[model samples]
Target: MNFASAWNAQGPLARQRREAMLARVGQLRALEQRAAERSAEARAVFEKRGQLLPRERVGLLLDPGTPYLPLCTLAGYLQDAREPDASVPGGGVVAGIGFVRGVRCMVVASDSGIDAGAIQPMGLEKILRVQEIALQNRLPFLHLVESAGANLMRYRVEGFVQGGALFRNLARLSAAGIPVITVQHGSGTAGGAYMPGLSDVVIMVRGRSRAFLAGPPLLKAATGEVATEEELGGAEMHTAMSGLGEYLAEDDRHALGIAREVVGRLGRAPTPALPQGGRVTASLPPPPGEGWGGGAPQREDLLTLMPANLREPVDMREVMVRLVDDGILEFKPLYGAATLCAQGRIGGHAVGFVSNNGPIDVPGANKATHFIQWMCQLGHPIVYLQNTTGYMVGRESEQGGMIKHGSKMIQAVTNATVPQLTIQCGASFGAGNYGMCGRGYAPRFLFSWPSARTAVMGGEQAARTMQIVTEAAHGRKGQRPDPVQAKAQFDKIVQVFESQADAFYTSGLLLDDGVIDPRDTRAVLAFCLDTIAEGEAAQPRPMQFGVARM
Candidate 1:
């Protein structure tokens, strides 16, 4: 049945919720702008050196008019700095998926504007995550390299140890038949020298590029030898003698142009081609928004579908209508009302949709397990809209084998062959996160809404549970709990849990790919689906080892 008749987009509650959500969206945009502005502050410095900013370099490399979905822009927010107001997000990197020529590539640029593009701990993690994506999708890895390398003063042994993976991934990308391209715009000293050394193609700017294992001072100190940067690892030296760079240019703009030319000439094949001479006709599904109904459900209603209070129940089908192309064909709707299992179209792509109306009961877990397997059989990707407190707990649920059934659901999520995507729509607490394919379960991509909160359990629930345990201990010792002291402790625990559970806080640690606005949910899903579709149809040649520099 169509959802048009059931939805009330103009309702008073809907209007109020939409306003609240709009305010959250504005705040998200402002944070992203803050990072951009931080980088823009270095424009004068860059211009004086006849160079372009990191973002300007990225824009020049990408194909004009194509969509660019930036990822993890708020990572390190309130994490690297002491105060929230002083925190600069993005982990000193600018990364996303965008087009180069006609080919979609994973583009990563070092935000040298901030701290000279020093590798922040979270920045290293961000690069690793995106590199994993490139490998999984078989997309080309394009890097705009210009780093002061790891900040020596702030170095951690763990960061230095993990930094090796950056070079390793570059090699792996080449071995997987995914081209690793680099444009060296500035400093690439010490460990950073390996960035371009591992790439399949390296484009360097003549006067600006430097890729030395050690600068002048270090050289003299180590071996009593004196050598200038130009003599050691300048672009001209590397291109002419060291064989580290494949192409050299006179300026930053020229280097980026050479990068574009190199990509254009890679001779990569398009998506899987049809059989040459067979009389085979493939039947494709109707375009989005054409089959079940004419238009999409009002996205404005999405805000209202989720109440301000996480404990309040919501009809997730209201959310489904706004995201799906037309209407949902629900499965086992009567069998497990708390868990929604349905088939829907997202941008003409058939995806099995799972959402939670409340805690997953025995039947709800069973229903999800079966739906997941069925979707895998049909080769359809699964989308999880998580808003769960966890599986049902208490006497009846335990007797009904909740644990075993929940295990089945988690197992299904873990081993599913098709790609899975998750949106943290509301409360994702306890084992429910595992069952819903949360970050730990490794969904292909996971994003959260501004209102989403993730924790082992709710703050109040956790505090109350601890309080009960404390009272029991005191009773065992023949000493009653001091009510004032107990309440103080309870409040402290709640505050800590609640603060850490916020979406922005979790995102700062790269817990999710990024936090997205609820209104953009459908568009994000469509873009991601398109990306997965392209990768699935691509055929890349794999080698035993990555291409190595001679």
Candidate 2:
């Protein structure tokens, strides 16, 4: 029982065991020192690039003085590596649980200094494990991605494959209902693009970050098209064309700042009861045409303000600003010119806006889909501005799968639970009308300007209908009717549609709620907002679905 008596009884075996334990402790201390050195190296690389390392990013994302529970602490083995102690979890990616603005969040960030942040099969497994943690904990996920692509060199290793597991993890993350915010601080190419695409929000820095499914070299070799890195997948491409990025920052710091702000907005606890002494509808403006100094401006005057041709252009921003609050925060303004969206205070209450472009055939129908889905999740009212001639057509539209995309928009709007209010400015025709949350879509209130044109098709399509009718009227056996008289009859038929006015009298039946002046849009939206806010009781959080593209 005594220490010396026990040691003497054990003899040589006890001495050997004691020495082995000491040796193992020394080995652990050495490993710890190496890990520290590697972390410092990683931090130095980021500092040289004027950026924060993965650890620093995590710290910034989490609340001050919070501890991070790391998921893994070891990296995989690699053949022919010179340094014996080169591998560790910090070498691949740093992932853990932390608090962000007091809300628990799962944080995962790539170690850009090691292997250029290339994701090996092991690293993919680690990321998936972290995603699982987020799901289990019901914590919002944040991915600070700065990677090149899959680790091609690791393919030869046992249990290694070419396709990484990040894609599958992304699918699971989407289904878990944990909101993922992905930030691209540097190059994000090939497989790296999927992480950001799978998240609810993607933030990218202008000059420091880029994301692409294919890089320039591969593109040039495969298609004989040459492009620079920036041209291939720069901030402009994703933000303006691909619609993959939610917000564009001036630099890396700005991007991180934006990510923090977005997470705060999304993670705030729902208010169960109205604040004490708070007015129920203090911010709401009165109903349309009530307590007003002057009636809304005439629809004919608004028509003159808009562009003439569908192919031509006008700044829909001007129209939105005039209709909504003074400071409208338009989201994805540079992407999809035909679709417009924004989140802003409508009569001092947050609301979502989805609108159609009158000048282009871009079926912003998909934007409407995203808008409706967003509203359902946020539990906010939606305002739609309708001015579309119809969904885009022709070969280009077909190539983009306009029909499929347009259908999704229609389905989202019709199925949405949130209060939707639509205003028809001029033209609302074809499927575009329904996608814009039209009357048939069951908006709480559907109003149109006096000059609004509501129909199954546009005037040009109506002209064709008249032409076909006139041609059919003249049979082969009988002499053709007088050409001038036939033309006059066609004109008369078209005039009936023109004089129909607003959404009513469509198909020779009353369909619309009624027409309101253009200037009354704000008042209408304000009243709708108040009604929606007052009606709904507190509801449970939304169920997660497959990842949204943008």
Give per-residue CA lDDT, model 1, range 1-550, as digits (tens).
3344375778887777777766766777777777878988998999999998888888888765555667887888888756877788899999887777777789999999888899999999999999998888888899999999989899799999989999899889999988999999999999999999899899999899999999998899999999999999999999999999999899988998898888888877532321121110111111111122222346556766676668867778788878988788889989888999989999889999999999999999999999999999999999999999999999999999999999999999999999999999999999999999999999888999888989999999999999999999999999999999999999999999999998888999999988876766877787788788888877788899988886
What are the runs in model 1 whose C-alpha is more than 4 Å off? 1-5, 269-297
Query: What do the candidate models score in CA lDDT, each in turn?
Result: 0.85, 0.61
| Predicted structure 1: lDDT | 0.85
Clashes of 1: 0
Per-residue lDDT of candidate 2, residues 1-550 (tens digit): 0011111313453344334433433443344335435655766667777887655666666655433334343333222243545444333676655556655567788877667787755566557666654554456788999987766665555433434556666666667555788898888887678778777789988877788878888798889988888888888778888898889988766887898888779835532322221111111111223222333333112333343233334344545665544557766566675687877667677777777665334446666677679878998778877777778888987888987888887788888877777777668877777888776776765666544577777655686687777677676546676878877877776776555532323311223433443444565566445434533432325445666685
The candidate maximizing lDDT is 1
What lDDT, from 0 to 1, does candidate 2 have?
Answer: 0.61
lDDT of 1 at 196: 93
- Runs of candidate 2 with Cα error greater than 4 angstroms are 1-33, 42-45, 77-91, 156-164, 268-544
